[model samples]
Target: MSKQTDAAKEGVQQLDAAAAKVRLAELAKALGAANAAYYQDDAPDLSDAEYDALKRENAALEARFPDLKRPDSPTEQVGAAPSAGFSKITHSQRMLSLSNAFDASDVQDFVGGIRRYLGLGDNAPLPFTAEPKIDGLSLSLRYENGTLVHAATRGDGTTGENVTSNARTISDIPTTLSGAPEILEVRGEVYMSHADFAALNARQEDAGDKTFANPRNAAAGSLRQLDPAITKSRPLRFFAYAWGEVSVPLAETQTDALARLEALGFQINDRTKTCDSGEEMLAHYARIEEERADLGYDIDGVVYKVDDLSYQRRLGMRSTTPRWAIAHKFPAELAWTSLEGIDIQVGRTGALSPVARLKPVTVGGVVVSNATLHNEDYIAGRDANGAPIRNGKDIRIGDTVQIYRAGDVIPKVADVDLSKRPATAEPYAFPTACPQCESQAIREEGDAVRRCTGGLICPAQAVEKLKHFVSRAAFDIEGLGAKQVEAFHTDGWIKEPADIFTLRERFGQGLQQLKNREGWGEKSAENLFQAIEEKREIALARLIFALGIRHVGEVAAADLARHYTSWDALAETVDKAAPAATAHRAAEEAIVAERAKAADEGRRANLSAARDAAWADTQPEAKAAWDDLIGIDGIGATVAVSLVTTFQQATERASIDRLVAMLTPTAPETRATDSPVAGMTVVFTGSLEKMTRAEAKARAESLGAKVSGSVSAKTDLLVAGPGAGSKATKAAELGIETIDEDGWLALVGDG
Candidate 1:
């Protein structure tokens, strides 16, 4: 009977091992597919929770049957294959993956294993670094002599795709580092935070383009774009996590290495902490997990790395994961919930977005009652039969939709189950007029957005705009909020940007009255006034953006400021701009006629004759003035016409004059001629030798000479750096002189 029991036990063990092998194979394949979708294609097939679950299952099976683990298992890889579109690059040192622990017990067990391996005493504590595992694409950035040379996305640990151009577009990823190592290869994650991703997706939907699923997908897509221009448009950011290959050693500990990275112009995740023991690490993981939703970015787990580099070296690594580091993933936060109704929200730009009001459900440890439907098109399952669909078919009042809370904060409608939709459900009809202002809503050609023509008159738009004006990225006026903006706008205390400056006078009469109201006091009023005073002398770029000009953003504002120098100069430029010849005659007849005669036989003959007669022979004084105006960079035919047309309006001109009178503007600093290729017309094409194309362009711009996107006849000296392809040929055709890196350096007196 005992021998029979032993045989049964052996059979059970064999069955379990066989099942574990099959599970490991399945997990490996699933993980590989998910990785391909996430990294190579910039499209994820599985939810964050589902992906983590699969990964966890794979890890468990691998632990049970360590001998059956495959070399190409997802557990053994750093990242997926290199994206085909980007140039392939091999890393100097292979990027290793981390082992994982899910809970406090798991963490304690891991620490125990480490102590046993090190032969330390039973109660001995290990110092470690606990940091949020940013859910973004892993990348390696190489620097030579304090300047960024190249950037690559992690692909299968040993090899990666070169994303130098896209990486350069990230504002936080510095082109040149300060106090940097002689040669450094810093590893980090490129990501778009939740807020930025939402905003980006919103813009993309409004522009009638495909929207990203989440921040991770958006960051991956943006980073892998072939054209740097596309990447520049996305709000992608980077956070340094670890080192790849370095000429000079960093610090003795992981925490010190982080400090060094921060000092060298790399942005490190702010949620990193040092722990004296595994218990402290577990505590930190709990605290961060609790505060996860409040954070603007997505973090799937917490990473605990051995602080001491020497200790880490001693621990070494397994064939796959590092022995000194482990990832403590938070539990999955997704759950099924019923969709109750759909509501539409009007944004500051008058974009009407559909939102799903769901039966409250807990996902990722947070209660979610609402999910963003994105737009009308998203509501409907099909595209326009023939015509371009504006908004997706409006989501009906009642429909069963799959809801997901990414990072336990942003609730988004993932899918709709038409089978469960009510039989009585009717197609939702989008409003043709502004709900708040009764203004006509117009969907412009080639635009998906339907905006109200009421402008600042709409209460919803006005309040939102006012809030944006005082937002941290804008004027940053203290003591002002969405509620306060609405209150002030409702009371007629402020009407436009200029009204913000006049708030003291307009609200002075009601100042004492406001102080008497709830949540208002003398000190509060004084603080508000002081805050407003502080913003009176804002930078030219901020002032331009705060005005909320159509189609103008931070980058555009910066460009305008750099070109015009001050508020007055920019006002003069924009106002003096005439209308383009192609503009509607009724809208710009006078301005267009003033600039150029109509295309008629007699007019063409007269213009030709005037040109042949030379500047001295015909309108010499006017010619000199026109030449002076046209010579300015960024001032072209379209811009010049727009400026002239604006200035022609008496009301617009008066407003500009008033704004200029009330404000003081500062001049931008001139470039220094110390760097190589300074003051040279550098046209970067194909590839680069020393830096990313963006870094080279930025360097050239800072030094002086104009940086034109296309090679032109007027190009004085084209610095034909490495990767000089079509532009180099164009320069030769135009008889534009060209130089290599050494020649460019000599010209700039930096050789």
Candidate 2:
């Protein structure tokens, strides 16, 4: 080696852990801020080469001081914070970021890393698939029993924005898939074609409207539109190359899995190929890079993944990236911009999300104007974990912000030019009240969000909830949409959910019928009524979810419905759980009163006594119900609280009762015939290392078992993971059989 190169290596080797740690900390902070600017704000502060060099430095430092590596290291992250425009979706399994390979040596190192991690020799040839990495938004499309239910974006790995409505508008995405698993999450890239992008921009320019910079940005902006019709009007495509949660394995190898996705009517990239060695993978990458422009869509680089699924499982994952895969990303471009203003938007859950509005600046071809501010803490210059960011520098209006866009990625704030900061700038104040309804907003303990407590009266929450109720996964009544629901609510024809079912009866007299209303015809009015009547018989799971319980999503509702089987059973159980809910609220009041009068220990003792007294007042039936609801595998005290509190409220109950009176809730379906675990009420707690919690529940249900979220008197078994909590103690108290992951897997017979 050259003297200079040898000296650099020797210098790195001479550094002790303590000194290395200092450098590592600096590298981590710098790298993190740079990434946030690139990924979150689409405003890159550093050039591509500079960013890569910083990452390399961080990786080398971590190698020197392995123990000093923080869990939030930028090397492990994939995407930026999800934009708050739509409802947020949490993935069952984490969507990991990929390790990057910059050049041929990097690609060689990637293969070598996998081999070394798996204890394979240099001579051993492991097959890998090299596919063109489409530079577009990543999406996860979930299906249940061969039917496409929803689609979500890859927002910060664990959670993303729900784009199910706009996704449904894409002709390339299948609404139904026959011969698919009972549960499947097919992951892929969603992008627009070159020709389509040009046409869209042309139309925009002609209409004197905002035009997109590239196909990727066009695809992202269009797909995220609140109006599905707009997305449908634009031409977009998808290429399924991977997956997340699944009921059954798709294929033994990556190539076969891609074939399976294609057979299921998904579009897979045609240029994808399997390579047996590093050299072959590099050759494929070269070919793709050479032909990228002619592919009709944008592809930034080549992605190489281990062909064997078994090897992938064995290799597993690090903090952010999987050991079995790497993405050879193209270089990034950067630009400068000015921070104009910040705005707050309230979601259905009453979360006040802050958005950064920027002065239009061209970055990587896209005209970027706004980016995700994430939360109040972010604006105040703090990380999610409360760490000071950019030396604790707060983002303010009138500051010159750096920005960048790569492929279809959103433009993000890369960094701030402190020299350009204005003296008149003031710290952005996060609102303490809902922006829409002016209700007092509150951020719960251990939560970053400040939620508005005006559930019944808040216009934003009420409207979003109503829209979700008529959404495809819920009631899915024909002719009812977001606009229609808003209109009905405004016209006093529909107020609460129950009013949707009563529309015809209230407004259908000869002269007063909906047919006589403006924009209404006799045939259309009759069709809507028939549609409403047809939906009178709904599934229990759908009904439960349509209620818009805070913690009860489609999966949770399914878990509850399957455990109870019948609507009346669930209602009665929730009603019985009400006493516990009342006890909880009473305990809260007692704790506050006791704390004011006593020391810590005395307060604790008094609180325990008050809770015991409240429980003693609860009827035996109510106590049993509370225990049972809490006994479900996923149901916790918080979820139980939401359910019981909603059920016990007079107004809530009146609306629910009216809806139930008007419709019949059919029993949730289960596949229990001739299965050993069929009819078994099971609760899974803690973490299951073998499969995701969702996957475990799905497997158990496929064998005819009823998986409940919590532990209760009716629970037959508890599948406890490591560090099992109160549920484990309760299971012992209830004398319910408890098993570990291995025991549970053995009982279900992993297939």
Candidate 3:
């Protein structure tokens, strides 16, 4: 597994069945939301690498426990649902998503799996077609009587959004074809070349409009526009690779099919080739990856497919993916850049994060000028555990550092080039105090980050939170951007979220104070007021996110809002859950202390047992509340504790109460309600022999059960396996029924 994949599945290997179930639900929710944002909204939430890591993690868990896959598992789905702006078109043939291969071993395994499935020997002859997997929108074009009729995007595999009018505007797409199948559907990618994408972004900036983030996003946005004229104004290209629906076969093999498509006036990727062996295919992939930056277009990876059409048909499909094809994704891109300077930035939570300002350098076709330094330890050539990194050669101001971008992830300083370091360059000294407020900064034990102790008194933290309140994904007030928020706070006009609503009443009373201010006009000031008033009634998820709570981002906020549904409900739950959260923290602290004191594993286990026994003595009501809070899908103790701690603070609670009084927060989006385990709380303990812990959890959730990590009075069912210890005993003590793995299988019944 890759480092990123390991990060995604951290602690999952040792998780009890119940905990794994909770994690699986969290992954499913996150992946689903990310897909919708990327495919339907054209605004991705996760980087390509992050998405891939999560997908890989989910697949690994599913493989470990095949029976526990969720009904909404990302592995069993393609792209998200199509946008409602365009007409819907059900595909004549499903557009399957290809499985991914990240390493050489994975590719070898792919070949082995194919050969084994076909009952062939190791030396069996097998030819494969390798081509660039275009990082653009997937489109399927239908041609009747050798004439192009319609075009549709690959939406949810089975249905798509109709974009025939916009597709006709692309210069690369042929309006008519000759000597083609009587009824055919040509499938390929619609992309924007690098040059065209850059030029289009420049034009957009000149027009005072929002520019795209990358070539892939630009191409998707351009091709999916409702107005064909707008799409025509943009530069878009197409490459035909496969056939969807054909009255007659295109060719006997994949290589011949591409030739036939090109001969029939359809543009095909010139890099497509036929490889005789897996080693040859890997060599071809390496060559493509090497030339990827110079391709003038985006290509995330290389796609390999069975060469013979008969072989492809025999392999067929598996729900949403094809068994005959796989995409070997490129690794993170790396480049060396000079470290010009280091800057410390304070976030809303008062953590000091170091950012490395670098000389402009291109990596994977993107010009990167800044990279993340992570923390002080990282700068000192060490990890959080004080282990040596980069051979313990510390990063200096004048050193050349190798920076890497993982797909679209933020760039990070990976390694230092000691050969290019200047002799005069000295080791960097991280700040001892907050740069914005001059307050003492301290690094807590076991934490890699150094944080300021200034709390809300720190100007940076206060200003950042205010800015977050009106960010695009939050309240999104018009005329209120980061700059405006900073200026307003500096001028003492607004100190918190509640102050924004009182702006007109306090500043607009007498001589038009805001209107007369520099860079402000009557219309603009009134517009800002109007925007603020319009957002007085906001969605519960947006309101929760705008609070700038620690570890609660847009997705987590949405999850919380969906669980609680109303501000009152969430506030009440948090208030009631505080005591339980405190007790849980004490238990955790006890375990940590035991680990520090214990000399061996046996001693530590004994201490843990004693801690669990003490934890069982907690008040039942508080435990129930905590259980309810943590039982929400995609939610866990980290978020629950943060929410409770924030609410426990007197100042924070007062501010939140005031803000809640000033605005109305609507309910969250409704979820599916019909399932066998609906409203039931399930817990799993000890070892699961039949299925992996993660798989069992997902399978239970698919049947509508809320999986909890700890045994509580609220638990409806307790699934135990061999070696089940304290948790099983506790369940039995609480008069809850305990079942073996076989019993669980019988109850869930193959999910």
* Model 1 per-residue lDDT at 654: 65
Segments in model 1 whose C-alpha atoms lie over 4 Å from true places: 1-334, 383-394, 407-410, 507-511, 575-578, 581-660, 669-690, 702-706, 710-717, 721-738, 748-751
Q: Which stretches of candidate 2 lie over 4 Å from their true place?
A: 1-128, 133-297, 300-335, 383-386, 403-415, 509-520, 582-620, 683-698, 708-712, 717-751
Give the Cα lDDT of each candidate. Answer: 0.66, 0.74, 0.78
Looking at model 2, residue 488 earns an lDDT score of 78
What is the lDDT ranking, best to worst?
3, 2, 1
Give the least accurate 10-residue stretch of model 3, judged by summed lDDT: 7-16
- Candidate 2 per-residue lDDT over residues 138-217, each given as its tens digit: 89999999998889988778988789999998888999999999999999988988998899999999999988756766
| lDDT at 587, model 3 | 83
| Model 1 TM-score, 2 decimals | 0.50
User: Which candidate order results from sorting by TM-score in descending order?
Assistant: 3, 2, 1
Question: Residue by residue across 1-751, what tens digits does model 3's lDDT show?
Answer: 3443332233223233322333344455557667778888877766444555456545545544444454346656678778879899999999988776656666888888888666667888899999999988899999999888899999989999999999999988888988888999999999999999999999999999998878777888898888999999999999998889999998999999999999988889999989988999999998897899899998878999999898887677766778899888766556788999999988767878777899999765567787666678778887666677677878899899887653223356767889999999998999989998999999766656778988888988898789778765689787787779999999999898899999988874522888888998888888888889999999999999899787676667876786577999899888888888887888888877777667564553556675776477677767778887887656789889999999999988898899999998998544334654565678888888766676677677557666677777778888998898998988989999888899888876662
- Model 2 steric clash total: 28
